[model samples]
Target chain A: MTSVQIEVFLQTLIAGLLLGGLYALIGLGMTLIMGVMKIINLAHGELMMVGMYIAYWMFVLFNIDPYLSVFIATPALFFLGIAIQKFLVNPVLKVESILPENQVILTVGIGMVLANLATVFFKSDYRSTPVAYATNAFYLSDFWETSPIELSLSVPWTVSFVFAVVITITLWFFLAKTDTGKSIRATAQDLEAAFLMGVNVKLMRVITFGIGAGLVGAAGCLFLPIYYLFPSLGGQFTLIAFVITILGGLGSTIGAIIGGLVLGVFESMTATYIGMGWAPVGRFVIFVVCLIFLPGGVASLLKRKKFGK
Target chain B: MKKFAPFIILTILAVIPLTGLSTYMLHILILVIMWSAIGMSWNLLGGYCGQVSFGHAAYFGVGAYTAGILYSKLGLSPWWGVPLSIVVVSVFSLVLGFIVLRLRGPFFALATLASGEVMRITTENLVDLTGGAMGILIQKRTWVDKTWYFYIILLIAASTFILVRKLMESKLGYYFVAIREDQDAAESLGINTTLYKTLALCISGVLTGIAGAFYTNYMGYIDPHVAFALHDISIITIMIVMVGGVATYWGPFVGALIMVLLAEVIRSMPGLGTAHQTLFGVLLIVIIIFLPNGIVGDYKKLKRLLGFRRAST
Candidate 1:
């Protein structure tokens, strides 16, 4: 392994890992909604756009640092999610019971409304939070590389990778250990059973939505330094998030983190090796093949191996 | 009674182009007619079969690009290209259906979406072939007049509606309704769910492809953005069908007309150019909330409300 090659690999790995963190955050929200609401929330991307805009304004108007304003922005988005579920989503739940197609129309219609609403209010101009470190990359020593196996090489990523790992681990612990987390899981397993067990299913759903929104809010803060933020930018991220959510196993948060990182690196490598135009096609091929082979997601594969499905 | 319905609808539609409408109004009407055909075809697969596609634009784009490419590069008549495009896209749809039709619900939608985006990006990136983002513009031939285009679109729309109406009234329609209601139950009853789904998709794709060919030829231009946007597919097939009444014949036709007419009226309003989408959003919300069944569906509802006997499905 030459020094320059090692440097390039490190850079790619760091970029891929940071990108994965953003994917995980967005995927968390989507998976959360899927687990609790049983709705795909096609408008999830627009919600992320909302988060980015909120962060963008906080930076531009009040001179607030993107990372620091996560505290405030997260709660605001949380409230927005709660309100959407309570007012917009609840009414349609009944309708969907009668007509399953109603949910698709409702969520897709909401997505369209959100996108155009953002366009009307924000004027479709792309804006981002301008932080001092937006483009700053920390280059580690240029001579550190080792090949672990024939096909795989090990490279050390910088702070961005650490940030992603830390956030993912934090979320994993929170979900595994917290009482509210238990409520969410219980709700996901079976709504009626959870209700019989005295769980406030609706309250849990609202909180789950809030938590998901808050996660995306944090992701917006993290993402501002890495990529260009625009209203329509959410579309790209949302698609990737869906891939991650599916790859991870539809309702599993930890699976989202691992699956997102894998997908990010896979896509990065494909785009690097193949034509950029083919990258999307490659990703779709992966999705299709996975759906064919492991329709239950990677986590389900693990579950089946463990429990004998 | 069923025999006269198609004749009555075709007669009424035939007079539309010759009614002395303005070119601009005629243009909008042409678009409405084109979309009505596309929407009804979409309703066959999505609304009837319960297999929602967020990627119908793939077939539409294939049709447009096929015809456009043949005409520009090979000096072939568009008439030749239209059928070729339909064959190409129908095959594409069949293969795509084979891959995706087994997946149920949201996964199916997501898979189709991924495929559509991939196609869009491919079209935009293949600059030499697809003209990239700038798109391809064909020279307008004088013989293919705008009024002729209008009647052509009308004929296509009327025929598509009749074909779908026939299919819906057939035994295949019963199988589709059964699949939509409950796939497992239908399968248990010996309905070959896969065959019916692929059949529906093939039919849907061919019609949508033809509409795409008509659009490109009439406008004399083709672009990736308009050709493969998920928004276009969703709005035409999903929203129109939802507003009209999913799984119902004539739903998408009535829905597309109502939507296009309303959209044209809104766009014509001065100072409302940028806010036009907001109107669409509002209309969508209104349709979803109050009039969950679209105009025709609402008509039936109102009739039943006024002490009329319920019409059989």
Candidate 2:
């Protein structure tokens, strides 16, 4: 390939890696909720949207940096998630229904409400953080004058990627070292067992939902500088997160991270090779292929290899 | 009187267009009927078969586009798209069913949702065939008067009601309910779960498609977004079934009526117009929590709850 082609390829790869980091964060939240609740949170993306809106307003009203808004929005979203679980979802779980998908539908309702409220309060017009350094980037040519190819990474994207990695590491540590985290993990593995151990299964479910919401909210804050904000945009992200979870194998955190990177790279390739509009199609294509060929996802394969299956 | 109630309601509905009501009311009635038909189809799969599809718009959009394409490309009347969509949507659902029917519960629902998005993106990109995002406009509507349109939709809705009622009473319907109640048990009992699920999906898709075709002809325009809308067509279909009555015969119709009226009221509110979805979201959450079986399914509970409050008052 020509030097220009190589440069384009490298740029796309770098962009995809950056995107994957944020995607992993988004997927991590949904997967965690799915793990503990055993119910798909359709409003997962909307929780992120709520986070984004909070960040947007923080920037608009108070001149707060989007990254700093993460601290504020994450806890607020956690409480919001708690309220939804305690009120909306808990009732649905108790109410005897013919269809077992009531909680999922309830999440859809919650998502709809959140999205519409945003549309009402913050119109449908697309908005983005006008961070001064958004355009600032590290150029290969600037670093190496005699470099064979040219490539650049946007400053905000690099910062967001770094933040995502740090948050992911923190999440990993919390899940591994913390008592509440272990309880949450135990609840996910076996609800009855966890209950038998006096883990407060109900409280764990609520907290898991909160952490899931908070994680996605933080992802929203990280994504704000690099991505545009809109009310209805949540649905697309919801699909993206769903795809990542399926690709990563239901509730596997490590798998979600790997799936996110693969998806990001694949999407980047599609955008570069095909067309920008087809990027969403690439996401679903990977999803369908995963369902067909690897129904268990990356997590299952990892487990099988470890077990020598 | 109870047995004849459906016939009585049908007769009343048939004559209402003759009462010289305003055109606006007629328009609203048309939407209610259209939505009712779609809701009934959804109820069959989601309520009875226990397959809660989140992407009925795939069929709905195809049905609309089938008619829209006929008018725009084939130089045929859009009305012909209605009958044609039944065949088109059935075949379409069968192909889609091969994949989605493999998964159960949430996975199946998400797969169907993905399929709807796929159809939408395909249509948007295939501008030559579908007019893509530009949409198709039927320049000459078959009838300027809304009477014929209303009658046609009413006929569709009435037939849908009859078909649903008869199907539920038949063996096929029993199998659907059995699958919904317990897939493994049904399978152990020699019910071909896959075949039955596919059949249910086909019928459900065909019915929703018919509504879509009718919409294209009545509205004289078809677009990917409107036809295959996730929230408007798909979720509203679920909401209709959830709010009215999940498995009841009259549930879809009642739900559609209330929803359409609620929409009109919400839309007319000046400052709160954009918040209509918020109201719908609230209503759905309330229904799921308070009346999980919907208004008709939980009739006794609803009545008792109201009666107890009345007695206290």
Number of the top candidate by lDDT? Answer: 2
lDDT of 1 at A264: 75
Per-prediction TM-score to the true structure, in the order listed = 0.92, 0.98
Instruction: Write candidate 1's Cα lDDT for A1-309 as tens digits.
Output: 876666556656655665666677778878888888877777777777777778788888998876666677778888988887787777766543224656656766776777777777788776765676655543333333453321222222234345556666777777789988888899998999999999999899988877777777667666665556666666666677788888888888777877787787777767666766776777777777777887878888788878986
DockQ of each: 0.46, 0.79
Interface RMSD of 2: 0.8
lDDT of each: 0.75, 0.93
Measure candidate 1: CA RMSD. 4.3
- lDDT of model 1, residue B129: 84
The sequence of per-residue lDDT tens digits that candidate 1 reaches over residues B266-304 is: 778887766766677666766666556665666666466
Model 2: residues with Cα > 4 Å off, grouped in runs = none
Model 1 chain A is weakest, by summed lDDT over 10 consecutive residues, at A148-157
Candidate 2, residue B26: how far the Cα is off, in Å: 1.4
Model 2 scores a TM of 0.98
For model 2, how does the per-residue alpha-carbon lDDT over B134-242 read when each residue is reduced to its tens digit? Answer: 9999999889999999999999998888898899999999999999999999999999999999999999999999999999999988889999999998999999999
Please name the candidate that would achieve the greatest DockQ relative to the true structure: 2
